[model samples]
Target: MSSTAEPAPAADPPSAPAPAPGRPSAPGFGQDRLWTVDEHLADILAAVHPLDPIELQLPDAQGCLLVEDVTVPAALPPFDNSSMDGYAVRTADVAGATEEFPAVLTVVGDVAAGSGSLPEVGPGTTARIMTGAPLPPGAEAVVPVEWTDGGTGGGAATAMSPAGPGDRGAGGEVRIHRPVEARAHVRARGSDVRAGDLALAAGTVLGPPQIGLLAAIGRGRVRVRPRPRVVVISTGSELVQPGEPLGAGQIYDSNSFALTAAARDAGAIAYRVGAVTDDADTLRSTIEDQLIRADLIVTTGGVSVGAYDVVKEALSSVGDEDEAGAGIDFRKLAMQPGRPQGFGSIGPEHIPLLALPGNPVSCYVSFELFVRPAIRALMGLKDIHRPVVRATLAADRTLSSPAGRRQFLRGAYDAEAGTVTPVGGAGSHLVAALAHADALIVVPEESSEVGPGTEVEVVLIG
Candidate 1:
């Protein structure tokens, strides 16, 4: 050895870092690039914003969120009306009236629903009013037609069969047998909702009942966040159409159908594209073609680091900053079945695309974990994910999972017992098991094994 180390021989040109023992030096297929589910979800959601509110007709606004507080422009009933097909008479006129001693009154006229010409009832005069027909000017009460012998002394009448003016009261005289109180069986103006009252709050979801209420308040069209249009694509060379015969190495494409239904269940209008082959150019071109109709894009498969993992290879250069849209990024998450994923924007409009694993179970789980929330966010919904509940394990054996990965095992939840039973094993290809599962039992990353009676979090998927 020279006197101290002959001037450190030019620090041997900084050799490149060595790859970890069994992991790739690059990001793909490597544990070093794994993302937590929450981390990936947060990133996907940060880029998503609610769609602009538009005035859509009542028929088109179903499942959409209301943007503004809808006020009742006019009273819900608009005017006093009869709630049943009966005689409209003054309460005092029919006092103590019964079948034995009936108060006979002259039939002024017949009132039908939406009739503009309403007769005024005065003193002993009465109007045969149909349900929803506006109350006559002087009427104070209404008695069912059954109580008055159906104006025919015949058997009980199911309805007032007088559809035309010619058939209006062939029975000239009407006898009011039973007595009625003031406003009896009458729908008063503003009884349901008054003018200027709130018909629906700003964030109300427009279901059938809500739409009916808005219509009752004269809201033919209202401002609402429109339903997102999701385009679902499945990429795999070994995939075939659902009805078509499969070859030796081919499988029917189920991810597209499953995810499309899932997206619709999450309140998006979903369109499914048949499986794209394992070619990068074909997948990229197909996505470009679908961009015009897509508010969000979801693709399953071709995201892993296999030789034919075309989603990464194809969409990696999908968007350029010089163009109008952005690029897609693939990521691996620290979760079972649904670890391989991708999410980003693409095309001129910069729509969001979520890439899930190709396996059927993994694809569906990924949808519930990620795509559903993204769709809800686009629809301006505050609650995004499926509600999770604490449930006890009903399994007889302890469940095992990988050390550092959060495991979501398919489960059948018994709501009454407040327990969840695992459906299948830890295999990601257990599609049949997934079909039987109504929920997912979430086992935390730190807890590798769970015994019976252990309380676990269950996410409702049904």
Candidate 2:
């Protein structure tokens, strides 16, 4: 053997075993292998886009997204107006007036609200002004009518005075019992909103307050983002419409109604697309029709791997032979109550479709967790998601969860202790539990066990 130990046997290169047949390829090194709630959400959002803008009148502008900036049309209170029903006087003249030693000022003229005519008050003169009346020239203050006794009651007293014929009556006078500050009881012009100032900016979601702002700015109509129209359907032959007689193993369809309400609350127009059986052909036709007619389509049920599961199979069939198949892009999210979720573009129109689980509670949770946020984003809402906060456990308890999945458990939030107590059993099929819960407490994937006094992030539902 040549010296040097025949060059230590050539080290064998690290080998990657081939992927098992019918199994997905192993994820690249350093890349994420499992779908997180956020990752799946990003993929779902990357599909359909927002709608175009439209012009709508104020009567129809409720909940519409404002597309343009609104500026103050004119200064509020076009002119300095009186805010009190009283006598307008020169502050300098009444500066020392009091009940004991009153200031006698000759009554000049009266100014009513909305009157264009205004007269100047000379020294020792006062103008009778009503609330909302423009301050007359030379008037620097308002003395409430209650503080002034017997004003020039419209100058008619001079004509009706008890004096001999051909003898002119003396002009009536008023005694100022109190002094008021200059500009008192007056709302200065442009005080509320100055002209040419921006009152509302673009992309503002118009609510009662914003609508009132528009009216104040003299805007009778506004341009806004079009309301996203959505169609919701429930699939499952075992589902029956409410108010109808139920047969064996059948329950009333609730997910559709719940989702529709959720969509509207998110600022989107929602319409029921009706229910469909487990047949692939029927579902495909129904979904196609909905895609052609709606901006988005949402359905519950038929997405799992059970024998009755037909949604995923139908979607795969539709995607066949098409470069970008209309097939549903199902995401097995590492989240409880909403694992069997699907998102994809539908048909050539590329309308967004989201398929949620059929469980009544799961569908509702998925809508709150995913669909509603998307709708809010499209409608230009600022607070798109429900606010989340840390809460303590109300009682000692155990929550079982898969070692690697983030679990969302329904519970009630106690404001006093800033804690959330789990509501009912930890099963996704618990509809009563869902109804009683006021929030969803989040348990991170890394923690398989959590005990009392441990801080947790909770989503307030109520």
RMSD after CA superposition, every candidate: 9.0, 11.5
Q: Among all windows of ten consecutive residues in candidate 1, which has the lowest summed lDDT?
A: 1-10
Quality of model 2 by C-alpha lDDT: 0.74
Model 1, range 131-188, lDDT digits (tens) per residue? Answer: 8999989999888888886564433555455448655553466777889999999999
User: Can you give the lDDT of residue 166 in candidate 2?
Assistant: 38
Candidate 2's displacement at residue 382, Å, is 5.8
lDDT of each: 0.81, 0.74
Q: Candidate 2: minimum summed lDDT over ten consecutive residues — where? A: 1-10
Per-prediction tally of clashes: 0, 0
- Which candidate ranks first by lDDT, i.e. highest? 1
Q: In model 2, which runs have C-alpha deviations exceeding 4 angstroms? A: 1-34, 100-113, 118-130, 148-176, 244-247, 277-282, 313-326, 381-383
lDDT of 2 by residue, 368-419 (tens): 8888877776676667789899998775666766676778888899988798
RMSD of 1: 9.0
- Give each model a TM-score: 0.90, 0.79
